[model samples]
Target: MTTKTFLKAGLIGALFSAVAAHSALAFPANMTTDGPTNPPVGHYEFCRSLPQECGSNPGSAAPGVLTREGWKKILEVNYEINQAVTPMTDKEIYGVEEHWAYPDKVGDCEDYVLLKRKRLIETGFSPADLLITVVLQPNGDGHAVLTVRTDRGDFVLDNMRNKVLLWSETEYTYLKRQSEQNSGRWVKLQDGRTVAVGSVSQ
Candidate 1:
Protein backbone atom coordinates (compact mmCIF):
# COMPACT_ATOMS: atom_id res chain seq x y z
CA MET A 1 0.00 0.00 0.00
CA THR A 2 1.00 3.61 -0.41
CA THR A 3 2.47 5.41 2.59
CA LYS A 4 -0.72 7.30 3.32
CA THR A 5 -2.79 4.15 3.07
CA PHE A 6 -0.36 2.31 5.34
CA LEU A 7 -0.57 5.08 7.93
CA LYS A 8 -4.33 5.08 7.75
CA ALA A 9 -4.47 1.34 8.23
CA GLY A 10 -2.21 1.62 11.27
CA LEU A 11 -4.43 4.32 12.77
CA ILE A 12 -7.55 2.24 12.22
CA GLY A 13 -5.88 -0.77 13.75
CA ALA A 14 -4.97 1.26 16.80
CA LEU A 15 -8.54 2.48 17.12
CA PHE A 16 -9.89 -1.05 16.88
CA SER A 17 -7.46 -2.18 19.55
CA ALA A 18 -8.48 0.69 21.80
CA VAL A 19 -12.16 -0.10 21.38
CA ALA A 20 -11.55 -3.76 22.14
CA ALA A 21 -9.52 -2.99 25.24
CA HIS A 22 -12.20 -0.73 26.65
CA SER A 23 -15.40 -2.32 25.47
CA ALA A 24 -17.00 -1.91 28.87
CA LEU A 25 -16.42 1.84 28.79
CA ALA A 26 -18.09 2.27 25.41
CA PHE A 27 -21.27 4.27 25.22
CA PRO A 28 -24.72 2.74 24.73
CA ALA A 29 -24.90 0.34 21.83
CA ASN A 30 -27.50 2.48 20.16
CA MET A 31 -29.68 5.51 20.58
CA THR A 32 -33.28 4.78 21.53
CA THR A 33 -35.90 6.05 19.15
CA ASP A 34 -38.93 7.33 21.03
CA GLY A 35 -41.53 7.34 18.21
CA PRO A 36 -42.40 8.81 14.91
CA THR A 37 -41.56 12.47 14.51
CA ASN A 38 -41.95 15.10 11.83
CA PRO A 39 -39.18 15.11 9.25
CA PRO A 40 -37.08 18.23 9.06
CA VAL A 41 -38.20 20.59 6.31
CA GLY A 42 -34.81 20.38 4.59
CA HIS A 43 -34.88 16.59 4.67
CA TYR A 44 -38.46 16.56 3.44
CA GLU A 45 -37.51 18.66 0.47
CA PHE A 46 -34.45 16.47 -0.12
CA CYS A 47 -36.62 13.36 -0.10
CA ARG A 48 -39.05 14.98 -2.50
CA SER A 49 -36.17 15.65 -4.85
CA LEU A 50 -34.70 12.16 -4.50
CA PRO A 51 -37.63 9.84 -3.97
CA GLN A 52 -35.63 6.78 -4.99
CA GLU A 53 -33.33 7.22 -2.03
CA CYS A 54 -36.08 7.59 0.55
CA GLY A 55 -37.75 4.20 0.10
CA SER A 56 -38.26 1.92 3.10
CA ASN A 57 -36.17 -1.21 3.64
CA PRO A 58 -37.62 -3.14 6.52
CA GLY A 59 -35.22 -6.07 6.18
CA SER A 60 -32.16 -3.90 6.84
CA ALA A 61 -33.44 -2.26 9.98
CA ALA A 62 -30.87 -3.88 12.21
CA PRO A 63 -27.57 -2.15 12.77
CA GLY A 64 -24.69 -3.41 10.66
CA VAL A 65 -21.81 -5.21 12.35
CA LEU A 66 -18.78 -2.98 12.52
CA THR A 67 -15.96 -5.11 11.27
CA ARG A 68 -12.45 -3.74 10.94
CA GLU A 69 -13.03 -3.06 7.26
CA GLY A 70 -16.25 -1.23 8.00
CA TRP A 71 -14.57 0.90 10.60
CA LYS A 72 -11.78 1.81 8.20
CA LYS A 73 -14.22 2.83 5.51
CA ILE A 74 -16.21 4.96 7.95
CA LEU A 75 -13.11 6.76 9.16
CA GLU A 76 -11.76 7.29 5.68
CA VAL A 77 -15.01 8.70 4.35
CA ASN A 78 -15.48 10.97 7.34
CA TYR A 79 -11.97 12.37 7.14
CA GLU A 80 -11.90 12.71 3.36
CA ILE A 81 -15.22 14.47 3.10
CA ASN A 82 -14.46 16.82 5.94
CA GLN A 83 -11.23 17.74 4.20
CA ALA A 84 -12.76 18.01 0.73
CA VAL A 85 -15.85 20.06 1.46
CA THR A 86 -15.70 23.73 2.34
CA PRO A 87 -18.30 24.85 4.84
CA MET A 88 -20.95 27.23 3.50
CA THR A 89 -24.48 27.83 4.63
CA ASP A 90 -27.55 27.34 2.44
CA LYS A 91 -28.29 31.02 2.52
CA GLU A 92 -24.76 31.73 1.33
CA ILE A 93 -24.75 29.04 -1.31
CA TYR A 94 -28.36 28.83 -2.54
CA GLY A 95 -29.89 32.01 -1.14
CA VAL A 96 -32.15 29.96 1.12
CA GLU A 97 -32.17 29.45 4.86
CA GLU A 98 -32.18 25.64 4.86
CA HIS A 99 -31.51 23.33 1.95
CA TRP A 100 -30.08 19.81 2.08
CA ALA A 101 -28.27 18.26 -0.82
CA TYR A 102 -25.10 16.36 -1.62
CA PRO A 103 -22.14 18.69 -1.58
CA ASP A 104 -20.00 19.21 -4.64
CA LYS A 105 -17.42 21.33 -2.87
CA VAL A 106 -19.13 23.84 -0.58
CA GLY A 107 -22.30 23.31 1.49
CA ASP A 108 -23.77 23.28 4.99
CA CYS A 109 -23.83 20.67 7.74
CA GLU A 110 -26.75 18.72 6.27
CA ASP A 111 -25.02 18.69 2.94
CA TYR A 112 -21.96 17.18 4.60
CA VAL A 113 -24.17 14.53 6.20
CA LEU A 114 -25.82 13.74 2.89
CA LEU A 115 -22.52 13.32 1.08
CA LYS A 116 -21.11 11.15 3.87
CA ARG A 117 -24.23 8.97 3.75
CA LYS A 118 -23.95 8.64 -0.01
CA ARG A 119 -20.26 7.78 0.09
CA LEU A 120 -20.68 5.21 2.83
CA ILE A 121 -23.61 3.61 1.02
CA GLU A 122 -21.48 3.48 -2.09
CA THR A 123 -18.79 1.78 -0.02
CA GLY A 124 -21.28 -1.07 0.74
CA PHE A 125 -22.84 0.23 3.95
CA SER A 126 -26.58 -0.38 4.23
CA PRO A 127 -28.78 2.67 3.93
CA ALA A 128 -30.53 1.65 7.11
CA ASP A 129 -27.29 1.89 9.03
CA LEU A 130 -26.53 5.38 7.84
CA LEU A 131 -28.91 7.89 9.41
CA ILE A 132 -29.20 11.62 8.85
CA THR A 133 -29.45 13.00 12.36
CA VAL A 134 -30.51 16.41 13.60
CA VAL A 135 -28.98 17.77 16.78
CA LEU A 136 -28.76 20.89 18.92
CA GLN A 137 -25.30 22.23 19.64
CA PRO A 138 -24.32 23.51 23.10
CA ASN A 139 -24.97 26.99 21.77
CA GLY A 140 -28.49 25.89 20.80
CA ASP A 141 -27.76 26.06 17.09
CA GLY A 142 -29.19 23.32 14.94
CA HIS A 143 -26.75 21.00 13.21
CA ALA A 144 -26.76 17.84 11.15
CA VAL A 145 -24.56 14.76 11.28
CA LEU A 146 -24.39 11.29 9.81
CA THR A 147 -25.03 8.66 12.47
CA VAL A 148 -23.60 5.26 11.52
CA ARG A 149 -25.34 2.46 13.38
CA THR A 150 -23.03 -0.45 14.03
CA ASP A 151 -22.86 -3.38 16.40
CA ARG A 152 -20.20 -1.53 18.40
CA GLY A 153 -22.33 1.59 18.80
CA ASP A 154 -23.81 4.55 16.99
CA PHE A 155 -20.90 6.64 15.73
CA VAL A 156 -21.37 10.14 14.38
CA LEU A 157 -19.65 11.72 11.36
CA ASP A 158 -19.81 15.48 11.72
CA ASN A 159 -18.39 18.06 9.36
CA MET A 160 -17.52 20.09 12.41
CA ARG A 161 -14.98 17.44 13.35
CA ASN A 162 -13.04 14.80 11.46
CA LYS A 163 -12.85 12.38 14.36
CA VAL A 164 -15.65 9.80 14.44
CA LEU A 165 -17.15 9.80 17.92
CA LEU A 166 -19.91 7.87 19.63
CA TRP A 167 -23.27 9.64 19.69
CA SER A 168 -23.16 9.94 23.46
CA GLU A 169 -19.60 11.24 23.40
CA THR A 170 -20.63 14.30 21.45
CA GLU A 171 -21.84 17.32 23.38
CA TYR A 172 -24.76 17.97 21.02
CA THR A 173 -28.26 17.12 22.17
CA TYR A 174 -29.88 14.56 19.95
CA LEU A 175 -33.18 15.59 18.46
CA LYS A 176 -34.21 13.17 15.73
CA ARG A 177 -32.95 11.08 12.86
CA GLN A 178 -34.14 9.21 9.80
CA SER A 179 -35.87 5.96 10.63
CA GLU A 180 -33.88 2.81 10.05
CA GLN A 181 -36.92 1.11 8.59
CA ASN A 182 -37.94 4.08 6.48
CA SER A 183 -35.56 6.70 5.22
CA GLY A 184 -38.26 9.23 4.50
CA ARG A 185 -39.65 8.97 8.02
CA TRP A 186 -38.13 10.35 11.22
CA VAL A 187 -38.03 9.18 14.85
CA LYS A 188 -37.50 11.20 17.99
CA LEU A 189 -34.52 10.50 20.23
CA GLN A 190 -34.96 10.25 24.01
CA ASP A 191 -32.27 12.87 24.69
CA GLY A 192 -34.48 14.45 27.40
CA ARG A 193 -33.40 17.89 26.23
CA THR A 194 -36.06 20.40 25.27
CA VAL A 195 -36.89 19.93 21.60
CA ALA A 196 -36.18 23.15 19.80
CA VAL A 197 -37.28 23.80 16.25
CA GLY A 198 -34.56 25.68 14.47
CA SER A 199 -32.96 25.76 11.05
CA VAL A 200 -29.73 23.76 10.66
CA SER A 201 -26.94 25.89 9.29
CA GLN A 202 -23.17 26.06 9.40
Candidate 2:
Protein backbone atom coordinates (compact mmCIF):
# COMPACT_ATOMS: atom_id res chain seq x y z
CA MET A 1 0.00 0.00 0.00
CA THR A 2 1.09 3.60 -0.59
CA THR A 3 2.60 5.43 2.48
CA LYS A 4 -0.19 8.04 2.33
CA THR A 5 -2.92 5.38 2.38
CA PHE A 6 -1.21 3.49 5.22
CA LEU A 7 -0.87 6.72 7.25
CA LYS A 8 -4.55 7.56 6.71
CA ALA A 9 -5.68 4.09 7.92
CA GLY A 10 -3.43 4.30 10.99
CA LEU A 11 -4.88 7.70 11.95
CA ILE A 12 -8.45 6.41 11.58
CA GLY A 13 -7.70 3.42 13.81
CA ALA A 14 -6.15 5.68 16.47
CA LEU A 15 -9.16 7.97 16.43
CA PHE A 16 -11.56 5.06 16.92
CA SER A 17 -9.52 3.72 19.82
CA ALA A 18 -9.51 7.10 21.52
CA VAL A 19 -13.24 7.44 21.13
CA ALA A 20 -13.79 3.98 22.61
CA ALA A 21 -11.61 4.78 25.62
CA HIS A 22 -13.48 8.02 26.29
CA SER A 23 -16.84 6.26 26.09
CA ALA A 24 -15.72 3.67 28.64
CA LEU A 25 -14.89 6.42 31.17
CA ALA A 26 -18.09 8.36 30.57
CA PHE A 27 -20.55 8.78 33.45
CA PRO A 28 -23.15 6.09 34.01
CA ALA A 29 -26.55 6.47 32.42
CA ASN A 30 -28.18 6.02 35.85
CA MET A 31 -27.10 6.57 39.42
CA THR A 32 -26.93 3.47 41.62
CA THR A 33 -29.41 3.21 44.48
CA ASP A 34 -29.35 1.29 47.74
CA GLY A 35 -32.22 0.21 50.01
CA PRO A 36 -35.17 2.32 51.00
CA THR A 37 -34.34 5.47 52.95
CA ASN A 38 -36.27 7.84 55.13
CA PRO A 39 -37.66 10.74 53.24
CA PRO A 40 -36.40 14.18 54.12
CA VAL A 41 -38.44 15.90 56.83
CA GLY A 42 -39.48 18.71 54.51
CA HIS A 43 -40.56 16.25 51.78
CA TYR A 44 -42.60 14.22 54.24
CA GLU A 45 -44.47 17.28 55.36
CA PHE A 46 -44.95 18.49 51.80
CA CYS A 47 -46.52 15.16 50.86
CA ARG A 48 -48.93 15.44 53.74
CA SER A 49 -50.02 18.89 52.67
CA LEU A 50 -50.34 17.87 49.03
CA PRO A 51 -51.19 14.22 48.84
CA GLN A 52 -52.08 14.43 45.18
CA GLU A 53 -48.56 15.41 44.32
CA CYS A 54 -47.04 12.30 45.91
CA GLY A 55 -49.20 9.44 44.71
CA SER A 56 -47.56 6.11 44.00
CA ASN A 57 -47.44 4.40 40.62
CA PRO A 58 -48.01 0.66 40.59
CA GLY A 59 -46.06 -0.42 37.52
CA SER A 60 -42.43 -0.13 36.52
CA ALA A 61 -41.26 3.35 35.66
CA ALA A 62 -38.94 4.30 32.88
CA PRO A 63 -36.72 7.32 32.42
CA GLY A 64 -37.88 9.93 29.95
CA VAL A 65 -36.42 9.81 26.45
CA LEU A 66 -34.11 12.73 25.90
CA THR A 67 -34.57 14.19 22.45
CA ARG A 68 -33.26 17.44 21.08
CA GLU A 69 -36.60 19.13 21.74
CA GLY A 70 -36.82 17.65 25.24
CA TRP A 71 -33.30 18.84 26.04
CA LYS A 72 -34.20 22.32 24.86
CA LYS A 73 -37.28 22.27 27.10
CA ILE A 74 -35.24 21.14 30.12
CA LEU A 75 -32.79 24.00 29.56
CA GLU A 76 -35.57 26.53 29.25
CA VAL A 77 -37.32 25.38 32.43
CA ASN A 78 -34.12 25.32 34.45
CA TYR A 79 -33.11 28.79 33.31
CA GLU A 80 -36.57 30.27 33.79
CA ILE A 81 -37.08 28.93 37.28
CA ASN A 82 -33.62 29.83 38.49
CA GLN A 83 -34.09 33.36 37.21
CA ALA A 84 -37.63 33.77 38.52
CA VAL A 85 -37.26 32.55 42.10
CA THR A 86 -35.32 34.57 44.63
CA PRO A 87 -33.71 32.45 47.34
CA MET A 88 -35.15 32.76 50.88
CA THR A 89 -34.97 30.53 53.91
CA ASP A 90 -38.05 28.91 55.46
CA LYS A 91 -37.51 30.72 58.74
CA GLU A 92 -37.55 34.02 56.93
CA ILE A 93 -40.49 33.16 54.71
CA TYR A 94 -42.67 30.98 56.99
CA GLY A 95 -41.26 31.72 60.45
CA VAL A 96 -40.08 28.13 60.68
CA GLU A 97 -37.33 25.95 59.27
CA GLU A 98 -37.29 23.31 56.49
CA HIS A 99 -40.51 24.03 54.70
CA TRP A 100 -41.04 22.64 51.17
CA ALA A 101 -43.63 24.21 48.95
CA TYR A 102 -44.05 25.74 45.53
CA PRO A 103 -42.51 29.19 45.28
CA ASP A 104 -44.15 32.39 44.21
CA LYS A 105 -41.40 35.02 44.16
CA VAL A 106 -38.88 33.55 46.59
CA GLY A 107 -38.00 30.13 48.07
CA ASP A 108 -35.23 27.88 49.31
CA CYS A 109 -33.44 25.14 47.39
CA GLU A 110 -36.05 22.45 47.96
CA ASP A 111 -38.78 24.84 46.94
CA TYR A 112 -36.96 25.54 43.73
CA VAL A 113 -36.73 21.81 43.12
CA LEU A 114 -40.43 21.32 43.67
CA LEU A 115 -41.33 24.07 41.24
CA LYS A 116 -38.99 22.76 38.59
CA ARG A 117 -40.34 19.25 38.91
CA LYS A 118 -43.89 20.55 38.65
CA ARG A 119 -43.15 22.59 35.58
CA LEU A 120 -41.41 19.70 33.88
CA ILE A 121 -44.32 17.35 34.54
CA GLU A 122 -46.73 19.88 33.14
CA THR A 123 -44.57 20.22 30.08
CA GLY A 124 -45.07 16.50 29.14
CA PHE A 125 -42.20 14.99 31.14
CA SER A 126 -43.01 11.88 33.16
CA PRO A 127 -43.41 12.28 36.91
CA ALA A 128 -41.28 9.18 37.45
CA ASP A 129 -38.34 10.88 35.71
CA LEU A 130 -38.42 13.98 37.88
CA LEU A 131 -36.90 13.12 41.25
CA ILE A 132 -36.39 15.31 44.30
CA THR A 133 -32.81 14.60 45.33
CA VAL A 134 -31.12 15.60 48.57
CA VAL A 135 -27.40 16.20 48.34
CA LEU A 136 -24.66 17.40 50.65
CA GLN A 137 -22.94 20.51 49.42
CA PRO A 138 -19.18 21.02 49.57
CA ASN A 139 -19.60 23.06 52.79
CA GLY A 140 -21.38 20.10 54.49
CA ASP A 141 -24.73 21.86 54.28
CA GLY A 142 -27.72 19.96 52.95
CA HIS A 143 -29.14 21.00 49.57
CA ALA A 144 -31.69 19.81 47.04
CA VAL A 145 -31.87 19.56 43.27
CA LEU A 146 -34.26 18.24 40.69
CA THR A 147 -32.80 15.08 39.16
CA VAL A 148 -34.18 14.61 35.67
CA ARG A 149 -33.79 11.00 34.56
CA THR A 150 -33.61 10.72 30.81
CA ASP A 151 -32.47 8.07 28.37
CA ARG A 152 -29.08 9.75 28.13
CA GLY A 153 -28.42 10.07 31.88
CA ASP A 154 -29.53 11.63 35.12
CA PHE A 155 -29.14 15.42 34.84
CA VAL A 156 -29.45 17.81 37.74
CA LEU A 157 -31.58 20.93 37.55
CA ASP A 158 -30.15 22.91 40.42
CA ASN A 159 -31.36 26.21 41.75
CA MET A 160 -27.76 27.27 42.26
CA ARG A 161 -27.10 27.16 38.51
CA ASN A 162 -29.15 27.42 35.35
CA LYS A 163 -26.98 24.89 33.49
CA VAL A 164 -28.14 21.26 33.64
CA LEU A 165 -25.32 18.84 34.45
CA LEU A 166 -24.99 15.10 34.79
CA TRP A 167 -25.31 13.74 38.33
CA SER A 168 -21.70 12.54 38.27
CA GLU A 169 -20.46 15.95 37.08
CA THR A 170 -21.73 17.81 40.15
CA GLU A 171 -19.39 18.35 43.10
CA TYR A 172 -22.04 17.68 45.76
CA THR A 173 -22.27 14.33 47.53
CA TYR A 174 -25.31 12.35 46.51
CA LEU A 175 -27.51 11.27 49.44
CA LYS A 176 -31.00 10.07 48.52
CA ARG A 177 -33.78 10.74 46.07
CA GLN A 178 -37.43 9.98 45.36
CA SER A 179 -38.01 6.51 43.99
CA GLU A 180 -38.73 6.15 40.29
CA GLN A 181 -41.42 3.54 40.93
CA ASN A 182 -43.06 5.59 43.62
CA SER A 183 -42.83 9.32 44.07
CA GLY A 184 -43.71 9.07 47.76
CA ARG A 185 -40.84 6.67 48.46
CA TRP A 186 -37.16 7.50 48.95
CA VAL A 187 -34.04 5.52 48.11
CA LYS A 188 -30.48 5.97 49.34
CA LEU A 189 -27.74 6.61 46.83
CA GLN A 190 -24.60 4.48 46.72
CA ASP A 191 -22.32 7.50 47.06
CA GLY A 192 -19.91 6.43 49.81
CA ARG A 193 -19.87 9.62 51.83
CA THR A 194 -20.92 10.06 55.42
CA VAL A 195 -21.60 13.42 57.03
CA ALA A 196 -24.09 14.96 59.41
CA VAL A 197 -27.20 16.12 57.62
CA GLY A 198 -27.07 19.86 57.98
CA SER A 199 -30.00 22.20 57.67
CA VAL A 200 -31.09 22.61 54.03
CA SER A 201 -31.30 26.12 52.68
CA GLN A 202 -30.49 28.02 49.55
Candidate 3:
Protein backbone atom coordinates (compact mmCIF):
# COMPACT_ATOMS: atom_id res chain seq x y z
CA MET A 1 0.00 0.00 0.00
CA THR A 2 1.06 3.61 -0.55
CA THR A 3 2.39 5.67 2.33
CA LYS A 4 -0.83 7.66 2.70
CA THR A 5 -2.97 4.51 2.59
CA PHE A 6 -0.72 2.87 5.16
CA LEU A 7 -0.92 5.86 7.44
CA LYS A 8 -4.69 5.97 7.16
CA ALA A 9 -4.91 2.28 7.94
CA GLY A 10 -2.65 2.75 10.93
CA LEU A 11 -4.72 5.64 12.15
CA ILE A 12 -8.00 3.73 11.74
CA GLY A 13 -6.75 0.48 13.11
CA ALA A 14 -9.96 0.02 15.08
CA LEU A 15 -12.25 0.40 12.03
CA PHE A 16 -10.37 -2.04 9.77
CA SER A 17 -9.84 -4.64 12.41
CA ALA A 18 -11.74 -7.93 12.13
CA VAL A 19 -15.49 -8.34 12.89
CA ALA A 20 -17.44 -8.13 16.17
CA ALA A 21 -15.50 -9.48 19.15
CA HIS A 22 -18.24 -11.63 20.66
CA SER A 23 -19.88 -14.75 19.22
CA ALA A 24 -23.11 -12.84 18.67
CA LEU A 25 -23.53 -9.13 18.13
CA ALA A 26 -26.62 -7.57 19.67
CA PHE A 27 -28.91 -4.91 18.28
CA PRO A 28 -31.52 -2.78 20.10
CA ALA A 29 -34.91 -4.15 21.09
CA ASN A 30 -36.40 -2.31 18.16
CA MET A 31 -34.16 -4.44 15.96
CA THR A 32 -35.77 -7.68 17.12
CA THR A 33 -37.66 -10.04 14.78
CA ASP A 34 -40.86 -11.85 15.63
CA GLY A 35 -40.10 -14.36 12.93
CA PRO A 36 -37.79 -14.51 9.86
CA THR A 37 -38.91 -11.02 8.82
CA ASN A 38 -37.34 -8.01 10.50
CA PRO A 39 -36.58 -4.39 9.79
CA PRO A 40 -32.81 -3.97 9.47
CA VAL A 41 -31.74 -7.54 8.80
CA GLY A 42 -34.30 -8.33 6.10
CA HIS A 43 -33.41 -5.43 3.84
CA TYR A 44 -29.83 -5.58 4.97
CA GLU A 45 -29.45 -9.18 3.84
CA PHE A 46 -29.99 -7.94 0.29
CA CYS A 47 -26.77 -5.98 0.18
CA ARG A 48 -23.93 -8.20 1.29
CA SER A 49 -21.81 -5.93 -0.87
CA LEU A 50 -23.42 -2.63 -1.86
CA PRO A 51 -22.71 -2.74 -5.61
CA GLN A 52 -24.33 -6.11 -5.91
CA GLU A 53 -27.59 -5.31 -4.12
CA CYS A 54 -27.89 -1.61 -4.94
CA GLY A 55 -25.91 -1.57 -8.23
CA SER A 56 -22.76 0.23 -9.43
CA ASN A 57 -24.42 3.56 -9.99
CA PRO A 58 -22.97 5.22 -6.90
CA GLY A 59 -25.52 8.06 -6.99
CA SER A 60 -27.45 8.14 -10.26
CA ALA A 61 -31.08 7.13 -10.78
CA ALA A 62 -32.24 8.24 -14.18
CA PRO A 63 -35.16 10.72 -13.79
CA GLY A 64 -37.89 9.39 -11.52
CA VAL A 65 -36.99 6.53 -9.21
CA LEU A 66 -37.44 7.98 -5.71
CA THR A 67 -38.22 11.42 -4.36
CA ARG A 68 -36.18 12.99 -1.55
CA GLU A 69 -38.83 12.16 1.02
CA GLY A 70 -39.22 8.66 -0.33
CA TRP A 71 -35.52 8.06 0.12
CA LYS A 72 -35.72 9.05 3.78
CA LYS A 73 -38.49 6.51 4.18
CA ILE A 74 -36.24 3.81 2.74
CA LEU A 75 -33.32 4.83 4.96
CA GLU A 76 -35.38 4.50 8.14
CA VAL A 77 -36.08 0.84 7.52
CA ASN A 78 -32.76 -0.81 6.68
CA TYR A 79 -30.17 1.17 8.58
CA GLU A 80 -27.73 -1.69 8.95
CA ILE A 81 -26.04 -1.34 5.59
CA ASN A 82 -25.38 2.26 6.65
CA GLN A 83 -26.48 2.87 10.26
CA ALA A 84 -25.62 1.49 13.66
CA VAL A 85 -28.19 -0.47 15.60
CA THR A 86 -29.25 1.30 18.79
CA PRO A 87 -27.58 -0.35 21.76
CA MET A 88 -29.72 -2.22 24.30
CA THR A 89 -28.10 -0.67 27.33
CA ASP A 90 -26.51 2.67 28.21
CA LYS A 91 -22.94 1.81 27.17
CA GLU A 92 -22.72 4.91 24.96
CA ILE A 93 -22.23 3.82 21.33
CA TYR A 94 -19.57 6.35 20.35
CA GLY A 95 -16.93 5.80 22.94
CA VAL A 96 -13.50 7.52 23.00
CA GLU A 97 -12.27 7.73 19.34
CA GLU A 98 -12.58 4.08 18.49
CA HIS A 99 -14.95 2.87 15.74
CA TRP A 100 -16.16 0.28 18.22
CA ALA A 101 -15.03 -0.92 21.60
CA TYR A 102 -14.51 -4.52 20.45
CA PRO A 103 -13.72 -6.37 17.22
CA ASP A 104 -16.50 -8.96 17.40
CA LYS A 105 -18.84 -6.67 15.49
CA VAL A 106 -19.54 -7.55 11.85
CA GLY A 107 -19.37 -4.54 9.54
CA ASP A 108 -16.56 -2.02 9.57
CA CYS A 109 -17.23 1.55 10.66
CA GLU A 110 -16.71 2.74 7.07
CA ASP A 111 -19.26 0.22 5.89
CA TYR A 112 -21.93 1.76 8.09
CA VAL A 113 -20.92 5.29 7.16
CA LEU A 114 -20.85 4.61 3.44
CA LEU A 115 -24.12 2.72 3.37
CA LYS A 116 -26.02 5.64 4.92
CA ARG A 117 -24.33 8.09 2.55
CA LYS A 118 -25.24 5.98 -0.46
CA ARG A 119 -28.88 5.62 0.58
CA LEU A 120 -29.25 9.36 1.10
CA ILE A 121 -27.81 10.01 -2.34
CA GLU A 122 -30.03 7.34 -3.88
CA THR A 123 -33.02 9.02 -2.25
CA GLY A 124 -32.23 12.63 -3.30
CA PHE A 125 -30.38 14.54 -0.62
CA SER A 126 -27.61 16.87 -1.77
CA PRO A 127 -24.43 14.83 -1.75
CA ALA A 128 -22.80 17.71 0.08
CA ASP A 129 -24.99 17.08 3.11
CA LEU A 130 -23.59 13.65 3.93
CA LEU A 131 -20.06 13.21 5.22
CA ILE A 132 -18.16 10.12 6.33
CA THR A 133 -16.33 11.41 9.37
CA VAL A 134 -13.28 10.13 11.21
CA VAL A 135 -12.81 10.68 14.90
CA LEU A 136 -11.13 9.60 18.11
CA GLN A 137 -13.79 8.17 20.35
CA PRO A 138 -13.54 9.76 23.82
CA ASN A 139 -11.11 6.92 24.35
CA GLY A 140 -8.81 9.01 22.14
CA ASP A 141 -8.05 6.47 19.44
CA GLY A 142 -8.76 6.49 15.71
CA HIS A 143 -12.29 5.60 14.57
CA ALA A 144 -14.91 6.41 11.92
CA VAL A 145 -18.35 8.00 12.23
CA LEU A 146 -20.87 9.25 9.69
CA THR A 147 -21.92 12.85 10.15
CA VAL A 148 -25.04 14.00 8.29
CA ARG A 149 -25.20 17.77 7.86
CA THR A 150 -28.91 18.26 7.65
CA ASP A 151 -31.26 21.20 8.08
CA ARG A 152 -31.66 19.87 11.61
CA GLY A 153 -27.98 20.02 12.44
CA ASP A 154 -25.44 17.25 11.84
CA PHE A 155 -26.72 13.83 12.90
CA VAL A 156 -24.76 10.65 13.41
CA LEU A 157 -25.57 7.34 11.63
CA ASP A 158 -23.55 4.93 13.68
CA ASN A 159 -23.25 1.15 13.30
CA MET A 160 -23.09 1.11 17.05
CA ARG A 161 -26.82 1.91 17.27
CA ASN A 162 -29.98 2.96 15.43
CA LYS A 163 -30.37 6.25 17.23
CA VAL A 164 -29.47 9.15 14.92
CA LEU A 165 -27.85 11.71 17.17
CA LEU A 166 -26.80 15.32 16.55
CA TRP A 167 -23.17 15.94 15.56
CA SER A 168 -22.02 18.00 18.52
CA GLU A 169 -23.94 15.59 20.74
CA THR A 170 -21.80 12.76 19.33
CA GLU A 171 -19.03 13.82 21.73
CA TYR A 172 -16.01 12.56 19.79
CA THR A 173 -12.83 14.40 18.86
CA TYR A 174 -13.13 15.13 15.16
CA LEU A 175 -10.29 13.71 13.11
CA LYS A 176 -11.09 13.88 9.39
CA ARG A 177 -14.18 13.56 7.14
CA GLN A 178 -14.86 12.29 3.62
CA SER A 179 -18.14 12.51 1.73
CA GLU A 180 -19.51 11.77 -1.72
CA GLN A 181 -20.38 15.20 -3.02
CA ASN A 182 -22.74 14.76 -6.00
CA SER A 183 -21.05 11.59 -7.13
CA GLY A 184 -17.28 11.05 -7.09
CA ARG A 185 -16.56 14.11 -4.97
CA TRP A 186 -14.88 13.32 -1.63
CA VAL A 187 -14.12 15.64 1.26
CA LYS A 188 -11.64 15.20 4.09
CA LEU A 189 -12.47 17.27 7.21
CA GLN A 190 -9.84 17.21 9.93
CA ASP A 191 -10.60 17.36 13.64
CA GLY A 192 -11.02 20.63 15.60
CA ARG A 193 -11.75 22.44 12.33
CA THR A 194 -14.09 22.42 9.39
CA VAL A 195 -12.55 22.69 5.93
CA ALA A 196 -14.28 23.36 2.57
CA VAL A 197 -13.20 19.86 1.62
CA GLY A 198 -13.66 18.26 -1.80
CA SER A 199 -11.99 16.25 -4.53
CA VAL A 200 -12.34 17.03 -8.23
CA SER A 201 -14.99 15.01 -10.07
CA GLN A 202 -13.29 12.07 -11.75
In candidate 2, what residue range of length 10 has the lowest lDDT sum?
10-19
Each model's lDDT? 0.82, 0.78, 0.41
Identify the candidate with maximal TM-score: 1
Rank all candidate structures by their TM-score, best first, as comma-separated numbers: 1, 2, 3
After TM-score superposition, the amount by which residue 7's alpha carbon in candidate 3 deviates from its true location, in angstroms, is 39
- Quality of model 2 by C-alpha lDDT: 0.78
Please, what are the lDDT tens digits per residue for candidate 1 over residues 30-146?
888888888999889888999999999666757888898888888888888888889998899999888888889998998989999999999999999999998989988888899
lDDT of 1: 0.82
Model 3 weakest lDDT span, ten residues long: 29-38
Residue-wise lDDT of candidate 2 within 24-143, one digit each (tens)?
Answer: 655565788887888888888889999998887554366777776677677777777887899999999999977889999999999999999999989988888999998888887888
TM, every model: 0.88, 0.83, 0.44
User: Once all C-alphas are superposed, what RMSD does model 3 give against the true structure?
Assistant: 18.8
Give stretches of model 2 more than 4 Å off.
1-27, 58-60, 192-202
- The TM-score of candidate 3 is 0.44
